[model samples]
Target: MGAHNGVNNMHEVAPMEVSVEAGNFQDAERLDDDGRPRRTGTFWTASAHIITAVIGSGVLSLAWAIAQLGWVAGPAAMLLFAFVTYYTATLLAECYRTGDPETGKRNYTYMDAVRSNLGGAKVVFCGVIQYANLVGVAIGYTIASSISMRAIRRADCFHTNGHADPCKSSSTPYMILFGVVQILFSQIPDFDQIWWLSIVAAVMSFTYSSIGLSLGIAQTISNGGFKGSLTGISIGADVTSTQKIWHSLQAFGDIAFAYSFSNILIEIQDTIKAPPPSEAKVMQKATRLSVATTTIFYMLCGCMGYAAFGDEAPDNLLTGFGFYEPFWLLDIANVAIVVHLVGAYQVFCQPIFAFVERRAVAAWPDSAFISRELRVGPFALSVFRLTWRSAFVCVTTVVAMLLPFFGNVVGFLGAVSFWPLTVYFPVEMYIKQRRVPRGSTKWICLQTLSITCLLVSIAAAAGSIADVIDALKVYRPFSG
Candidate 1:
């Protein structure tokens, strides 16, 4: 019940830090004097938050990933990742409840849950990993958004050049512009208040995804059928088994990244206006709806995209769509993607903001912003807030500019974080919190699966990083 109210005010404590000092399970629940539920969001809005987090720039790469495995392996991998992610995500949601399902204590943030079950040391470790992953995601959004914007402009240039000269648009300026746009939304108070933006982002995800699928279908029809060499069953004739295995690993990483909302599950759940007892059910419903909705889009977009371009599908599906006949549609799709990332960037960044601001206030209790007293004129803003938030945005923007390869960088982050943040932590936390016996088959299977996922993700992450380094040999910093 001590959830953030989602709106920032001069008088109230930020929800992320509200109960940190209470030091007990019972204190985790913050209720009004009347003893009613205090959370602020409903099922629909919470689902939208999950959807917005899960289906970001990652969706843009699915076609290229699916192309790695051909039609047979790709869709199957997509379904497998969705199923596993949803199951593990629900396990994490159950961790929020501390006693009887009908009456239990609840933890608001992911670190709160970790501290409760794993102790303070583990909490510190988790914080480092969690914050790093979030910053990585924000950078990924900046890179992906800039790429989308540049794609549209480059398409325009192609026509102007009569298709005889190469397009010369640059992505650096747009990356900074995207960062500036994110800074505006990042200043918005909390997770709950941003529901409208999340809703719009969710809509834009579907819009661009739909547009991609539609264009793919039309292109396929015009071309008479699917065009790639190995669109049916086997890998391309020249693809070595080693190459196929490597590509499959990358594809799995992409699917894992696409389904990753586990890092923000509790934060999103905390936004739902339900008591601890009903929180699990609410989260289950929200996760189910979100995973189902995005899965449909992922499959359609992946399949149709592969069908349209086959081996030719670029790492980004929209960029590969290009400015063909009826090129305006491609432009519209790119714009929708840029708009969606603008919101997605903020949703992921808000938690990082909360974490940083809370720590600074705790360390310097007399600070202007932490004092609950409003300031005016020149003293209107907290220097801490302005300085750190701007720094976070700037850091991410610079990273994106330096490492401009979208698919590889995002995949590396996803592969590295997916195991611990999404799979391993949830399963381990659930087992510890519920006291699932080590000898139990269910317990053994879960641990084994978690370990397997971690190993696979590590290999994928390493491969992704190596691929990025190789690709960077020819990458110009400001080139489109």
Candidate 2:
């Protein structure tokens, strides 16, 4: 396979040289092996991208998920999910190039990797799952950013009007504001162009996560010792047995969502520069570092939050009013969350934009609407791109306003996308690419792993649906 890919890449060499000759001296050096603008992405930039995508608003729900699953199961589920994600990410990274790690045709997206290794109807299936997941993430981030925005206002209200005050404010306007911000940021032309944004977002992720962890620890100390049981929230008058089962299952979805950047792993890999060291190896290292770093934060935040609030932990520890005093600090943390989501929203949505634009260009070929661009000072703006991306943000924002059940929505998305995008596809692609042989020990183990996750995803999705139904019984998201 590697030799075949090497031969194929050899064909591109002549065209690349011809194109360079047609252009300037600088163009040759600025081009990659594939004739695209040179990818300046390095280990640090790749790690930043992973960190920005991995540690998102989803982290805020870890404590709540932990609360449902209890001490033993909560931490265990997080670790298990992290390991599974990292393992599958490594597999997907190996699929980044069809033949040779360096010379093979690059798979620019998750769907491309699927088409290369497990071609057929599966490529279409992968596209549906991957893009749907990205859209859901865009919606989820919109909802999360609004939550933080309202938290800031609510915190100020409480501080000014006294704790007894209702301190209410609707999230609809905030969601709209966030949507507007995203519309502006969505115009960035390429993933590599946003490396600085990713770096800043990564820093903000750590900032808010550290703040949440710190607040949980302080609250735990004040309460004196840990407050949760080995079994987690107990079944009682407030919590029926049926609800307990649903919550526990939904916890699985939350944790799964927290570790899921696999859908974008290939897209991230595409930004990496040509390598003496393969892009797959660099991506593997980034995955390991990101998973380990996030896992530690998850443990501390989840455990401490459960300890602080016991059975009553808020769905979002920071925004759920778990810490009322030090209103200024809460304000800063919430601001950081808002800033982080601003970057995260783009991190998830860029692929969708690229996909649509690519398809339009291929289909239209020379149509002015698809091919023309207007100069805006320093940046060249595409008419179709600006309209399409803006409309996309608006649609997701409207949907987010209608269904802003942050925790449940994320759980549902995680459940729906986890097995297909994160596990099954990667596992299948790996088997086919490596020709692992049917019914062999290794192949059986991989299939078993995939099947187990599928069952888990089914249950988690069912649980999330139940939770959503229950939430709608009193759903008044636009109201404070």
Candidate 3:
């Protein structure tokens, strides 16, 4: 709805006017130069953004996760988490339309909802975790993209111990190159401006997932049975008790992380063009449709890839397969993943960019650099904007280079932020914003689920951190 500032009395503000208000010349002048559009996309485009945000490198690891949990538990966990996240998404959708179901205001961002319901220190806490998760995930995208590229280029030149041989490609240079390309793409001025990117990214996700599943089917047919059928699939069947416990927890974390999208839900909803009454409904539809589509892909990819490779599957599906002559299909799939992650990194980072820009403006009311745009190559660039964003991309790229274990970093990020961003914040904010009765069943069940997720996330986060630490002990820092 309206801003918390009370400058505007109406519930709905035009998308262009977001963060820009009457009497705020800085916000207004910045928009005038940027040509940012408002309320431009329909339901499908909004769903595309949701899909782009939801499906990332996580899908590639699902089969390995299924291997950890076995056939019966793996698909079960995916469906269960999908349903839970979809429900939480709907709750978050309701929070976006806060004041009136018909014409009252709505929250334009996830932080907006947090500020409205759980203000004070919670807002600051939310902002910290939110930006950390965004930046961390962007780093993860860098790591994954670079790894995928390196895998494609050097799959045949690796050592027996998994290190790249001398003369083989390293992830560092590829990461820097990817970051350079992403810095260019990240210059899009508005969230709505990148709808086309999201659409393309979504299509790429479908393409890669389909390819993975098809390759699995082909491999099974060629081999005439499952890859590890003799050894069994479940962790508990052959592994020690301690191994099973850790592996199962990691699997749970991976699946839960795969379903995470709450951090960007409100921002994606802000892209939808509709009347107040229809806005919430449209967002709900988009969320449901995106989740449903991703769920189907996850099932196909996870089950089929597991059937093909079983426990031998690498954390990254693409990396699991050894190099084949004329491996153009695998190369194409990796290219698609890299392209999709380029868009995804921007989608998550845009919020952090907006936050930093707004803070700079508010903290320094008289700074002239905020609105000054100069020509850089073909794009108009602001010194303040370019400086911070480039720094952001650089920070993530350096981190990716430092810790290039793509799956481990992703799990750590998900474990740390999934509870607050995906589960807890939405449920708590909904109950508080809507004033759901303390004793009501809806309140009780939602709160219970949120708490359970928090506890589980804590354990998962600890385990993931241990894995990262163990990885650090052996990994040569900055090694090429």
Candidate 4:
């Protein structure tokens, strides 16, 4: 398809040029010291992007998932997932490293890199999948955020003996408001704003974890025993083995490695500017930071939640933690979650918008309104533009809201969406380009390993899809 401009021409962009034109740089000398368009981000900016990306709606469910796998398996799975995520991310970096440097400079997007190495059809497929996943993720986050907000409000009401169903009372209004806010946040012009948001989220997370831990300790001391001492904690006589199994299973779903790892890889690509050398180093550093930060956070949160609630930890761990005393702490945590989710939405939203913008430019060359400059307005105002980016966000948001119950479905879509970008396309490109040389056995072995990793990733994504389908069946009525 030829490139055009405007919303109507979105699908007409040739997939090969997706990256080159995404952040069109006309005067590199003016923007960079080396005559290349300088990237206006640093190490921390990359870390924040990766952290926000890795921590999302899925994080709220970590305790529940870990409960299913038990403490040992859950943490182990997270570690393994982190490793896989890093490895695959490295593969993507390698692809960028070997790409045509000139083309890389022009179209540095992930899709452009894939298209340059693979073909048009694969690029298109990857684009569609990526778009679908981001939209699903945005919707899921919005719904989950609404649910969390409602739960907190309801708890507040109940504490004062007030009767109200926060879920039913203002659910629709809150959801729409959240969706709008999410869109606005996603359009923030630079990393400075996002960095501040990330700091807020990090603070909230630490505060929530600390409060939960304190309460658990106090409860133990008050009962004349150390909490989690096994002997000190009382077990309910009526608790059954089956119930424990169910709780553990639920926890396992949250701590599942595949989904979490895939997401980290996606963030690595999204936040960093792609082109070899630069993209490679950025991806490597970002992946390391994301994994390290997320792993520590998950472990700390999981331990604290388990200690505080014991076997009674709610299916959504964050909800249970919020009930811990120091009401202000909980309030901060709530706000933090909201802020973090906003950041997540921005990271997800940008690429979708860029893809749309690229397509629009390709389809309608005459539409000056859809040109890059026109699309680069304030985040809120920019959403109204008839550009591919805006159109994708609007369409995705509506679909996501309509399918609010499809949490697993959204996760599955995200995993699937990441495959071509993070795994398959990268490996294929590396093999085809023969950048490593065919005569070397080490290179062949590396290729085989890369291929194996992609296959495993696909399998993992497939399993997640199955889970989503099953979840959809169980929650069909809620879809309305």
Candidate 5:
């Protein structure tokens, strides 16, 4: 199947062709003439990628969101979001299952899928949005990482000088450190090394949640016991119905905890080496596992965090609960989370690089022209021929550092990019390609559900964008 450009005589080839042109880089180091990764399929490889994608800066934010929404609605919303996630994930898996194997034509990257389902312009639009979103996530993760480190230092009395806050030490030093670590870790030539870091991150995450939850629960119980004394110490009151609604709606960001795993589906597809049919099954299973794991973790963390803070929990729940007595454990957890955030950055970076590489090859089909344009030494030209790859990394780092207060932006972009890629576009492909029985009950029900999901996703995108704007307007200093 091919697409015809509006220009009378010109025809843009099928979007699937780009996948063939882009070439799978999963095993570039061990690439055979077949243009496929050399590795055999394994369950662990798929599982690790999914796990890394699911856990990120979102972990801290989930509980705060739950606090905003009523406790009753929080888990319900997450469950609903999980269902939506599963449906969308299954649709994409179906697309992959039916995709052409020889040309790598079955599974399309986010943009390719969008272009095929919608049109070329949308592909470009979504690509730009996705790239920006990934950059925001990377920077946001870095900022959060730095803030977590600073918190640990202050808790341990490392800031000997009379500074009120550890983070205030010097942005320059932290920025330099963050940049060096990002470059070194990101340049690891194989997934094996990356997986090792992920394992460390997972262990740290478990420890962090366990410690933070225990301390938070203890504090909450203590505060509750002394409720009589704090009777009139109201921080704020719930007055209007609208206020309650807004609060509840805000909590829906907790559901986004699962949305963070959307990229994992793509990552698993890219990393695992299997025939198209097996790859599709693997992607489906991986997506389910990732979301399930994230959901359970968020629910546990949210409940504990809410109990700890009670009505007084700070907006950022995790930070509000100071590190507990096991100072060394807190330090380890903090460091581990920072490392996990780095892995999250890589998750965000891969697609950005892939998209840029495709555009680069398309723009300059001639190797010599591409080489001259990239302007690298001939020896390095083959490996670094894509301008957008480096451009994305530099631009992402600069923007992330400058927009240090980008939590809402990160969440918003995560939702916005996720909606079309995860929900609308995939459904569109399924309808057009599969053409489920037109008048049958199942077909009608499916269409109705798809339409509803599309509307909900649009609302989510709009709300998230507004939230980002509000956050930017009220940027504050790192008081901790």
Candidate 6:
């Protein structure tokens, strides 16, 4: 449409700003400092973007993650992760501008930041990891949204047929349904939170998260008190010792995945308006706000969910029938989940869409198929965007079909990206940009943090991949 605040051209990354190089108006006034568009993002909007990014279906798995870690380590692990995420995120905020906190050249994307600072093969490495993780997240959202969609029907089935019916359902059809929805939303253009659908989705994020927490509390009270063990699921008849180790390691991945929003932190920061207080300071404030808020909710949901079901907590807090009796409530929660995930899928995938479209535009500047926009009602759509975005959705959907287990996929994605995106890149970029003296105390501390997270990421990845392999032994993707 006419610059839907949701799909405003401000998000176009200023690539073609040369045409408007005369200056001014990303729908902005005076062109601000960069001669592109006057930036308008504020601390609050940045906070919303971070919240929407961080708190999604990931929270749904924390109960299971805690079950693996247990009472003693579950909450402790979460707190540790909260600290790491915030610390690294602040370090990253500092790198938004290359040389100075306030005056350095702005790196519009995460790729741009790495390219400007790290250069060399590392830029390629960053791109591969960043985009690959984006693809993995797209697949994870497919699996997750489908699970929520299928849960809706199963919840009804259990209520109508009684819990004894088992009410089994396959996620295949639901995943396809989710893919179809994404294709339509994908065509809407831009993943900025200003979009109407995005705002609704953000509300749904809070809605379901609160619902999960409430359900956990209700279940805990219904059990007369709490229900788990200090050590979590015990290794005896039901679980082998080897299984215990793998599950615990996988739990770290799941938690890491929950906090995996650092990859797009710079993209989110790019939206902030030119400021006297500086984007870094505002972003730091927003990072603290978003992380603190999500962490509190994570703790409430994870600990209470573990307390309610103990070692036997469901892998998905909402869909796993952890609160089976309240059928309507379960439906509501799952619906909220699907809605949130629908938006989350688009939000996360927007970067991939932009990168490809930009490349195509660069390579074939005159091809109508590459450069033309087809009008639909009030809005203008690109033929290329339509084709590629739909194809991407389909690819993700099929991949999700092959590997539908949410926990393992989420963990593996997190493990693969956590060390690189969240910890290492940020730490290295900060060290280089700030030029902490070689082998200095600050340098040593940052290196230690990076190394520790690398180990964690490695263990988590191994555990997730093992579980995936084991799952493949008996599970067939499209079997009825």
Residue pairs in clash, model 1: none
- Over 291-392, each residue of candidate 3 has an lDDT whose tens digit, in order, gives 999999899888878887777777888865532423678878888888888877777787788788888989987887887888765466888888888888
Q: Identify the leading candidate in terms of TM-score.
A: 6
Q: Report the Cα lDDT for residue 175, model 4.
A: 68
Q: Which stretches of candidate 4 lie over 4 Å from their true place?
A: 1-36, 40-44, 99-107, 162-170, 182-279, 320-324, 368-398, 406-421, 432-480
| Cα deviation of 451, candidate 6, in Å | 0.5
Q: How many collisions per candidate?
A: 0, 0, 3, 24, 2, 1
lDDT of 6: 0.86
TM-score (C-alpha) between model 5 and the true structure: 0.74
> For residues 1-480, could you state the per-residue lDDT of candidate 5 as single tens digits?
001111221121111222333354332434422444343444455665666566555666665555555466555777778778777777776565343533345444555555555675767776666666676677777677766665567556633444354434433345446666766554443343355556666666666666666666676676674111122112346535544443344445435534655543654565555443466677678777777876787777666666555454454444543434455656666676676666666656655555656677788777764545322322233344334344545565565555554345545555555565666666766776577778778678776776776665555556555555656676543321
Tens-digit lDDT track of model 2 for 383-463: 888889999999999999989889999999999999998899999989988889999999999999999999999999999
Measured against the true structure, the TM-scores of the candidates, in listed sequence, are: 0.87, 0.92, 0.86, 0.70, 0.74, 0.93
Which one wins on lDDT?
6
lDDT of 5 at 253: 40
How does model 6 score by TM-score? 0.93
Question: What lDDT does each candidate get?
Answer: 0.77, 0.85, 0.75, 0.53, 0.56, 0.86
The true-versus-predicted C-alpha distance at residue 370 of model 4, in Å, is 4.5
The TM-score of candidate 3 is 0.86
What local lDDT does model 3 show for residue 358? Answer: 86
Q: Write the per-residue lDDT of candidate 4 for residues 373-462, one digit (tens) a residue.
A: 434444433322444444555665565555554335433554455445555665666667656667588676766765765554455456
Q: Higher-TM-score candidate among 4 and 5?
A: 5
Question: How close to the true structure is residue 257 of candidate 3, measured as C-alpha lDDT?
Answer: 77
How far residue 316's Cα lies from its native spot in candidate 3, in Å, is 0.4
Error in Å for residue 340 of model 4: 2.3
Reference-based lDDT, residue 273, model 5: 54
Task: Report the lDDT tens digits of candidate 6 across residue range 178-287.
Answer: 99988887876565432566677889989999999998998899899998888889999989998899999999999999998999899889878765689999999999
Evaluation by TM-score, superior candidate among 3 and 5 = 3
